[model samples]
Target: MRFSRGAAMVALALMCLPGLSMAADIDGGSLSWAWGIPFAGILLSIALMPLLTPSFWHHHFGKVAAAWTLAFFLPFAAVFGPAVAGSSLVHAMLAEYIPFIILLVALYTVAGGIFIRGNLHGSPAVNVAILAIGTALASFMGTTGASMLMIRPLIRANDNRAHKAHVVVFFIFLVSNAGGSLTPLGDPPLFLGFLKGVDFFWTVRHIFPETLFLVGSLLGIFYLLDRWYYAKEGVLPVDPTPDTRGIGFDGAVNFWLLAAVVGLVLFSGFWKTPLGITIFGTEVGLPGLVRDAGLVAVTFISLRLTPASVHTDNQFSWGPMQEVAKLFAGIFLTIIPVIAMLKAGAAGPFGAIVSAVTRPDGEPDPAMYFWATGALSSFLDNAPTYLVFFNTAGGDPATLMTTLAPTLAAISAGAVFMGANSYIGNAPNMMVKAVAEERGVAMPSFFGYMAWSGAVLIPLFVIMTFIWFR
Candidate 1:
């Protein structure tokens, strides 16, 4: 029995495992050969993060944790490759993740520098008000739009305040992430669910209970924190001292421009819908139009319409967004090979994982998928991470509830709501950070932001687990 000690021991342990499936068997072909490369890549990037941003690493252990995760998963790409995968991983990364991340940075930089004009005294209350409004708006305007509109004011309100890192951290949890749970328009993952034939209104209905729970709980917490901070600092509420220069609604043009962009978004989603499209010499659809329109709108805002004075008032600059854009762009390129591998190995490589578990109701279990997909969404491109889960959830009888509708509801809620675990989880989060920095509220770095989530948000999610999922 000990003839081949270590190797044999490993083989025995693996085979004896419960629910072990054929997916674990590596054929040693192209797919098997390609496995594990992504894990290495992730590890390398994580290791390099601290080296590159030592000061950031100093207080942000959470960033270091994420870096380690990146390191660990990078190799999984090699284990996961082309022959076993389905969609082109490059398309997922580029078409899904990169553009949105870039857009967030650009919007944040522009708004942060130009529009933020409030003082820091009343910022906490304003931030709470913003989160409340944002949660409601998420259902209508989309979390991205609402976050973009509110983040600048939040930053401006807190501009004169120090020791407010917790404020922005909690802001991400409430307004950016948890708030978008109720509707397809609120989050991309839910939107993808809508495109996949799930009833759009179903998610909105089922998630209402969960949304109310989170909102009520978070707002209470935020108020206590806000009051405490205000009292400790002797901060007074600030009023927006009116500018008597009497420019009649001309400055409000930005609002109109912003609205125009929203209209374009709605039209693109409606017209070139995932239902498919064929246009002059090419077939383009939801993805195509969205990418095109989003870029066009952002470009117009960044390059053409934003007046010099607005930037001056908001303290806007291009650097933050550019940095985020560059980083995520690289991420988009690097993750393609990995995702491709995962899909390629779907049947055999991850078969065991895919098939091992079942829900309490004896349906196909989606918890693993939810957690893995969610973990990635928190750090990488949330949209693609979202799609990956949505795509994975497709066609699985086990993932559904007793009825088709409940199953879809579950998937949509998980994808949209949980995506807010990290700054990168939602586009608005990073923008909020850039805006905060522009207004001089020193926010926690990438990982530092997570500590706040781990402590506050994770527990809240546990309550949700029992209340909703259970």
Candidate 2:
């Protein structure tokens, strides 16, 4: 019933979205800080509601998300008129939200279908190995994809351990965030840069060093932590679903389907088309439309070919993806003003932010870019946060590639790495948290998780600044 209701709400929002409005002409200069209140409210709701009242948050999170979205839209419509409101709504949905959810769903569905059949005995070495593999895989299949694929197995492997929260916590650090810094395919922020004419190899060439530093350091820290925990747990619980046989995969076909999804994503990036169709005032490109269609088909193919037993083994359900879809619907909508304000740069209300990225000498400071980009990405969606900084750094691929290279690299690294600071910072962080909680691992609250990342990640970032960005 809740799913149906959420579906209806989403459908109505999409349908009501119309194009051409005050949003197109209105500069972010006119918008005030107050416009960002709804967005802040929703994120705060996400952070506090779970800790303060889990049952209420669990039951009506969708409603709360929707209400916050309406809080922005209703007032904006009244003040700016329906056309401006509709234009922002249409633009956000067509340009950002749809593609974002499509990619997440396809990856989640395909990865979830392929489950590891048998679990290994949890040892410090074994746990570190899994984290390392997942970290590496993240650069290829995406942080979200690698996380969904590896997290369940890791959880099962460590199920008998006395201390397990730290495992999932470190997984978010290494696998779900930092490991994705090396490639556009690995993380959305870099991928957005790629679509904006940043070279395919740009991230690999520049950000790879930072990625290695962060990922390598985190892995070492995790190993030490896991080793200590293993020594403390002198005895193991009888493995309920022990490895009866050697490790093997259950749904091999879904991997091909996953490959197809990846191919479609790449195809859209490389293949541009002049042909486009207008849907509800939004311009839809043929390449993007086809790619989304192909992804939807790949999702169905994964479902059809993969056995029911496979999904059952993975304990797969649509709940987590749906929750993301509904909540992000609200987020994407409410964030329109904030994005516009940032885009306004020095002319806009957030001019201080733009000014802060530059030194008095007029050179763009890479360290400040890293910290500022990271600070915003820690709260807002990292993809757009990256674009804001990328544009602030001149938005020229050639110049940014050569002259302002460190700035771009810092932006890329900050967007990907600091996303681990909060669950809502990246979609996968929340997904991992939700899944771990579902599996009986008591994941930390949103703020609690921040405490962990604040303690562990911030110092590393500071060290990285002195080592590289400086």
Candidate 3:
């Protein structure tokens, strides 16, 4: 009954979506600031509702998302006509949202199938090693994948310790956010950048230095803090989850599936094709279609091949993926006008934003871009916030990659790295928190986590600004 209600709500919302015909393009230069209200509202709701009204948000988040989608669609159709609104909706869905969700689904499914069996004691060194390994895996398998795959073992390893919450906090910092900086597959914002024409290896090539610095600094800090805690509150005499078997992987075949996902993503980026179809105003390329279809196949294949015991051991469920899909559906829809207005640059309603990140010489300030993108990414969903800033910095991937390389690097680094600032900042942050709490670890409250980030992450980001963004 619950599933049906949620599905029905999503279906009803889809029914209200704009028509399929292409119409007049939105003139961001002419759009009023009010057009951005729905975008802000939805993001704010995602950030606040879970903290303030957990039960209501948990039960009705999909409904709230749908409501915001309607808020944008109804007003848009009324003011701009259904044809115009439909074109925008189609463009967003076909060009951006579908591809984004498909990749996440593939990653989530493949990652969820692989269960890490057995556990080890959580000495400070062992915890740091787990964090470092998870951090490295994050670049290849995704932050979500690495987090889901590694969080359990880390928790189990530390289950006997009295002061284990800091271990999980560092896991969120290094594995869930900063470590994903090296690859597009590692983070949603980078994937979005890839979808926008940034080269497959562009992020790694540009931000490797920044990633190494942030991740290394985080690991070092976590080690010192964890060492103190370990000494202060020694482990219980008996391990809570003593090793029952040698540490090994269940559903290890998914590693190959993970490799295939990386291959498909790379193939799509490199394989140029003139053959394509048009959907509404957006062109659907052969490479993209192949990529998306292959990803869907990978998702199902993982589900079919993985043993039920592995999934059970992993506590795998579709709940997190479902919530993300529904929430981002609204985010993609509402962000249409915001992206449009941002594309209009200084002449648009968000001219102040443009000016704030601009230098007196009419160029972008990399430091300002870093801080601005990071500040909001700390609060809003980083993926869409990335798109917003990507457009704000003049949305041409080629130009941003070359002439404004520093600006683009700042934006990328900020969006991916500072997402560690809050639980709501990145998807995996909350997931890791929930998993830790489920295991009886007393994870900090939302603001308390912020206190951790502010004390630790903020100083690191400042040093990064001077060394790199400057």
* lDDT minimum window of 10 residues, candidate 3: 1-10
lDDT tens digits by residue: candidate 2, 176-223: 998888878999998888888888888899977788888888888888
Q: Estimate each model's TM-score.
A: 0.72, 0.96, 0.89
Is 1 or 2 the stronger prediction by lDDT? 2
Give the best candidate by TM-score: 2
Candidate 1 residue lDDT tens string, 1-470 = 11113222323443454433223222422344243454445434544555577677434533433343344334533444322221222233334544465445433433332354434344556677767976787666567667766666565456555467777777777777777777666676766655554555666677788778878888888888888887788543443443243322223556555555545544545453345453211234665566556656665665566667776655556554544444444455445544544444346454443344345565645445545555666665566555555555554433442354444444555566666676666667766776676566777755677777777777877776665664
Clashing pairs in 3: none
Instruction: Name the candidate, 1 or 3, with the larger lDDT value.
Output: 3
Put down candidate 3 lDDT per residue, 1-470, tens digits, no spaces. 24334434543454465664454588998998898888889877876787899899979988888888888888888888767777777777777778877887888889888888887889999998999999999987889879887888898889899888889999999999998998888888998898789987999999999999888888889888989998899989888675776878999999999899889987887787799888666788999999999999999999999999998887777777777677767777888888787667779987777678989988899999999889878866788778888988889999999999999999999999999998868878877886677678998877788899999999999999999999
Model 3 reaches what TM-score against the true structure?
Answer: 0.89
After superposing all C-alphas onto the true structure, candidate 3 shows an RMSD in angstroms of 3.0
Q: Rate the local accuracy (lDDT) of all candidates.
A: 0.55, 0.87, 0.84
Give the higher-TM-score candidate: 1 or 2: 2
Stretches of candidate 3 exceeding 4 Å from the true structure: 1-19, 192-202, 236-238, 384-403, 437-442
